[model samples]
Target: MSRGDAHAAVRRRVCLSAAVAWLALEALPARSATTQDATWPEEPDPAPGRGTPADQAPIDWPEIGLLDGRRRAPQSWAGAPVLVVFWATWCPYCLRHNQRVERLFREVDPARLQVLGVAVDRDERRVRDHLRQQGLTFPNTVDDGGLRARFTERRVLPMTCLVNAQGRVSLRIPGEMSADDVRALAARALAG
Candidate 1:
């Protein structure tokens, strides 16, 4: 081959290698970050009429059906810090966010921090398949219409809310979150 041709070939190979590396990295799960690795700011007091539904005194969360063919009554979680996530199966952001949540669920003591995923999709089978494919065992329930109304449907996927032991909503995040952010939220729940 000509010298020019050889150089061009080498450039092409380098570009291909970089592309492959990037894709592989993208497919890997995000590294779990401890709460100590990042700082979490306190949430500001909500303005009048601007509060989320869970912001109500002891959110009258209705009974929810679990994926495991069981029901979770609101009172069952009355005195525990519960992390409720509203997500859909097809949302890309939810895919990444749920992975971090799965990690947090596995790492923390269930008694200290209860995690619940509310799948907001219409197809129950799709939600189940997604959870099974992702190897996520955290308690997830397909959201019936009631949950959407009760949670006040923020029109955003992967909405994560932290409910303190007192049943007060402490924080509500409306989008994707980093590993440190998730950890810090759980840390705050544990501390509270």
Candidate 2:
């Protein structure tokens, strides 16, 4: 074959190969940007200050309740740095943070800081039994009416909101947090 013809044949083969590769890639399904099996870091990266805006009013806790039980206000958080944690007994991450929370309650002065658990589980008996089994002494309010709607409007479990002494939400942390993160948030809230 002529040199020019040979070169042209090679170019045609290369183009066909490139087209096949592009077609194969296009035929494959696209992967989701978000991952379901993402491994969370032991120490979460520094997050932005996603706190409640100053214009947002403080959440009224008393207006919320336990399943079929009387709704009562949070007495412990009155005029103190409050940690309002929305968790459930069924969530593994939530259960893991329970011990950390208990330890924080013991270490931190209750007069200066208070952690109130808000169980978002639909079943109150399960939560109560789990808390009792875990020997958790902190005061907890049940969200039978799904009071989470009043919080950050996010439907994620194990969300924690640090409320300052001035009754303002200073930080809203979604998902599990390490003990250090909790302490840092508590210290910030107390200092503020």
Candidate 3:
């Protein structure tokens, strides 16, 4: 081969190697960020007469159906620190958080805290099957009919909101959380 041809081949090989490395890195698990400020998207001002808190207004829980077929209304979250987590079965990050949530439920006292999982899957049957296969015993809600419209409006996902006993939203974290993170958030919510 000519000298020019050899150099071009070497450059092509380098580009291919870099692309492969990037894909490999993308496949790895993500670390939990301490703050979700940088991750959550900004919300637009509400139209006239909406009369709602910007952050809390965008979360429509009632539209989502809990595992027991009951609507996940605000009343359901009353008298406990509710951790409403929006996730999907296909998302790896979401799956990882699901495992962590299950562990938290097993270790933590339910009387003091509640963890609610909202699956964004379009197919309710598939979601139910997956939940059964995984042995996820906590209350899970499925967001059908684009019930996630509010959450999507805020550009949040794998998101979690900490609701106080009064049914008021306290904190919103817009990323994956570990078991330790759940415990810490619960502790703070209970203390308050």
Whose TM-score is greatest here? 1
Task: Return the TM-score for each candidate structure.
Answer: 0.73, 0.65, 0.65
Score candidate 3 by TM-score against the native: 0.65
Query: What ranges in model 2 sit over 4 Å off?
Result: 1-52, 63-76
Q: Local error of candidate 2 at 115, Å?
A: 1.0
lDDT, candidate 3, 17-46, per-residue tens: 999999999999875463332333433323
Off by over 4 Å in 3: 1-64, 68-74, 145-152
lDDT per residue (tens digit) for residues 49-87 in model 2: 433345456766555554436555656346887888888
Model 2: colliding residue pairs: 62-73
CA shift at 120, candidate 3, in angstroms?
Answer: 1.0
Evaluate all candidate structures by whole-model CA lDDT and list the values in order: 0.80, 0.70, 0.68
Model 1 reaches what TM-score against the true structure?
Answer: 0.73
- Regions of model 1 farther than 4 Å from truth: 1-55
Q: The CA-based lDDT of model 2 is what?
A: 0.70
On residues 99-145, what C-alpha lDDT tens digit does candidate 1 reach at each position?
99999999999888999999988888888899999988899998776
